[model samples]
Target: MTTPTLPENGEHLLARATAILAKGSQIEIRNLVRSLYPAEAAFVLEALEPEPRASLWRLIPPGVMGEVLIELNVEVATALLAITDRKDLMAATEQMGADGMVDLLHVLPEPLLSQVMESIGVHNRNRFEQALSYREHTAGGLMSQDVLTIRADVTLDVVSRYLRLRGRVPAGTDSLIVVDRKDSFQGVLAISQLLTHDPHTKVSELMDTKSPGISYKTPSRDVAALFERRKLLSVPVLADDGKVLGRITIDDILDVIREEADHSLMSMAGLTEEHDMFAPVVASAKRRALWLGVNLLTAFLAAWVIDLFEDTIQQIVVLAVLMPIVASMGGIAGSQTLTLVVRGLALGQISGGNARGLLFKEISVGLLNGLIWAVVVAAVAGVWFHNPHIGILLGAAMLINLVCAAFSGVAIPVLLQKIGVDPALAGGVLLTTVTDVVGFMTFLGLATLFLL
Candidate 1:
């Protein structure tokens, strides 16, 4: 199929492809799929429903299919892989790098995985196995075995000749990894040093030893942070015994950073970054039901708290009307603090050393905000109901709830993290519960003691 004119953007491409597919123009769809880059093709496929996605998947060239699969989210990729022909799967992976192959292996079933593994050459099979040994979210799994290594004792002239003979270096090869004869980590030699330095200079004489190799077991998030802090294009990944394993490039780190950002954003809504937007209705509902149930339970807890003070609410009906305001203000204030602390923890800015200070600061801010809003809310309540006592009780409840919300906001995330729960996923629900219960209890309990 010949390439057609590229669409302006992903939406346009999806629109054009949908129109073509509706017309039953298989050849046109093939050309359309082939015209865009792998990422763009993956985007269009993801945007389509299952039928159209499978249709477009069939049209993708085997050479590009591997890359498109690599670009897809885990759920979508796994679904596509399940129906794919074994021969087609082999063709798709034939030209893939170790890293790309590892990605496919993650979603492939045991039978298909074994077939694919057996199909690759021994050298590549070893590399793929080595990569598979590391957790998908760690440095080793994200690294590529296509690193260029040189002995530290080599001369600049020798390195230059080596590069010329090799014809091409790996993509993102900003520096040559320096290792000893036994492949122990030494340092890195920037490409600039090779071109500008005298030929007589030894690699060790010009190599930078300050930047250390990242351990293969290091978390991908921490690796991304290191890259951001050091402004690195690439870094060496080393085995536990300091043997060179592979190297992770900026592109890999960029993917990690993007996934992390997506994770944080999605988790706030009780979803995963890998969630399929077009998943089956039943599947989608099944995934969301657990969180919805959790939320319902929390809502019941808040309702139970309110039920305890039914008599006070009955005597002062205005308290029922004004109850939501107290809870809402506390929820909003706590959410603000929760967001700040979560971001700080993600960026490694908040730790044991500074967490106490941060907690005190957030509490103080909550107190100050409580005092300010309390007066405003109290004045409004007093005027609205013409009862100063009720107004004062409302204000006191607001202040108490806000303070408790602030404390819960900071403490909940830290505590959840300590127990190995994702704070982002569970923090919001827990915070809402705290604010609601505290706001209701303080407001109605005060009403019962005084106004009744």
Candidate 2:
């Protein structure tokens, strides 16, 4: 078992690194991995075959495993789950940070989840279960339960003493969570500052008494947003009883943002995030088909409006050809506004305090944009259709649909947010339906009045 020279590409390097482990040569692999950067090491670890990968479980130490697990995808985590026994799984998950464990656990089945949860110590089990109990998108679910804390009144000597003790500051820990004697959260202390502090000082002597923390029940999505707002490395999580339960770290928030951003992008296009290699091609198609069905249903509403103007469309072939332009423009504009509103909600903006202002802002934007596009497209259509009258009709139709699209786009998400609904879920459907309806009606109705 000797170190192999690095390769050119990530995949080639990853293969060579994984090959060393396959030959049961951990000593050489560990040394080589330690020398390489974390990114390269992560790729190597992720590329390993399941059997060899799990073998690293006993070979590599917790510190290394923690870093590697953070880089692995759900598929690789699933592979790890299949090969490792429950006890080994628990140990490995514990070695990883709390939030990392949650992310991995989310990729497993119910039976495995419960089994792993049960294998940890009672205290660890409690903390893990409590985090698992949180709603998936809230702050509580994504936060870790392993932060260090101290009473505000504690002297600098106590803080210094505790830190010097082995395992008091866990390796790979996010930050120290400061607390009152009653276990109420007080502030956050970074590891750098704690190590640098004088032996005579107390934690209470530190400044910034007002630290940002969340209730244990806050949504994980909200938790991620809080981390972004405060620019914190970690934020302490507390219970209603004021006991400090855990902490949320930037690492967890980064994953949350990535996953949520993916989910939002997919859902807005009416798709879910359940596809995988194990999933059958038919299964993936079916899941996608369900959303396509929703779109089909909504399309009928647009079709019915077109049917209403069947007489006019038949009389003028130009009306039939130009029909798609109005709806397409409105749909695109509406999607722009809808995407902004929905993303704003995910980021914890667009609150009741500013809903009225946001609404006004969207309407103003719509009016300005509608006027600008109406002029541009109208001139183009006038030249294309070779009729000033047709241009007038198209311009008015564009203005009507754009205003409607923008208005409905903002309104739909706000209404959903108001009703304790997720602004991200189903927002696209409602916005599209409204835009389609307006687009069809405005175009054909105006044609019937003026063009006919």
Candidate 3:
């Protein structure tokens, strides 16, 4: 199927939003979101100034805010919600689907919990509130309340008739769920199953109960794994009571991935996935600075190795300039390995048992790449610096750095997991720091021995 076309605001929309927000002109910003398509409206809402974003957020309808909130980063959503009224907050909450509400409630603190709960429709409030009791990372917290449930004893004609009402559910519905009169989950019947089945058959006769579905207490990431593994479009969410609470659609699972992915990507680059544009530059800088400071500490350790080679550097000025290249190459090479491992681990493709095999593959890749690249750099250093000994130094250091880089890059994530750290949270910084320090130390340490 062809993908729907997203708005092409592209380059200049941000420029325009900046201009509008800078004027403190609420009307212009409000008009921007109003004028755009729902997706575009969301984008515009996101780009509006923080001051105006909060002030003007209330001006937009709650439905619009809910739609836009899903598109906005959690940090930004938190900020916007902070200034919004309980009614508006609840309106947004009620407008959101089960999985979306799960995400919102997960982040929304306890004090505001009661207010937000009060706003959700009474029927759904119990289901959503039930999900809230599950552990944070579990399936229940990520499941949607937008399931279609039918009594198992209902006749095929009756089931088909009920399934025909797919689009009518309050939270927005698609899939059909089957349950006994006691509300215990029986099986799941897709919407298509209803139309295809004979009208006289019972729901219990028509539904597919044996299909695999995760319980609500499994971690959200594991829930994602089930979708990929089973190739399902939607999975049912069950209460502790075994009643069908909702179904977590693929879109909801995809959102979990997207959010986690955003966290990984932004955190990797030393940026926090925050929503507040109004936060002082210093605050943003401070967040970056902590990681930068960590990187700086590692860089200094690299420099300390150079300090040990001051004599060699003074004798051959070219070694000083050329060393960074060797280290930088290793850093880049290490990052490539790091990305692959991190993604594999996150996706469940590489688990604890297979991680060793992955390590072997990454290390081999690093070694082969180092050998090829080392030859190029060593040859260049030999000609550029007019010294055969320096060439040998470069070759040896490149090989060492690459090997070390590979080991460190793969190992850090694995180690973090072993210790119960969210490896994605700080893996990039730690991995980069490892490669950087090792590269510098090896490059300069080799130079000191061979060149001097």
TM-score of each: 0.95, 0.79, 0.84
Quote model 1's TM-score: 0.95
Measured with C-alpha atoms, the lDDT of residue 217 in candidate 1 is 94
Off by over 4 Å in 2: 1-107, 113-136, 171-175, 188-198
Model 1 global lDDT (CA atoms, 0 to 1): 0.89
Clashing pairs in 2: 137-220, 137-221, 138-219, 138-220, 139-218, 139-219, 139-220, 155-202, 156-201, 156-202
Report the C-alpha displacement of residue 332, candidate 1, in angstroms.
1.0
**How much is the lDDT of residue 142 in candidate 3?**
64
Query: Which wins on lDDT, candidate 1 or candidate 3?
Result: 1
Per-residue lDDT value at 295 in model 2: 83
lDDT of 3 by residue, 1-452 (tens): 99997655645776776676678766786786576554555566566666666665667777666666666666776777777777777667766666667666766767897777776678778877777777766776666655667887877777655645654653434456777879888777666766787778777776788866567877888888888888888777776788776677777778678767777877676675653555668777777778778878877787776787788779878877877887787888778877887787788787768888888988898889889887887788788778877887788888888988888878988888779876777787777677767777787777676556
- Which is the leading candidate under TM-score? 1
On lDDT, the leading prediction is: 1
Sorted by TM-score (best first), the order is: 1, 3, 2
Tens digits of per-residue lDDT for model 1 on 1-452? 99896447767777887898888787787778777888888888888899988888887878878889888998998888877877777898987766677877877778888998898889878878877889989998889888999998889999999999999999889999999878999999999998898999999899999976999999999999999999999999999889999999999998999899999999998999888899999999999999999999999999999999988778778899999999999999999999999987888888899999989998999999999999999999999999988889899999999898889889999998889999999999999999999998889898899888
What's the lDDT for candidate 2? 0.73
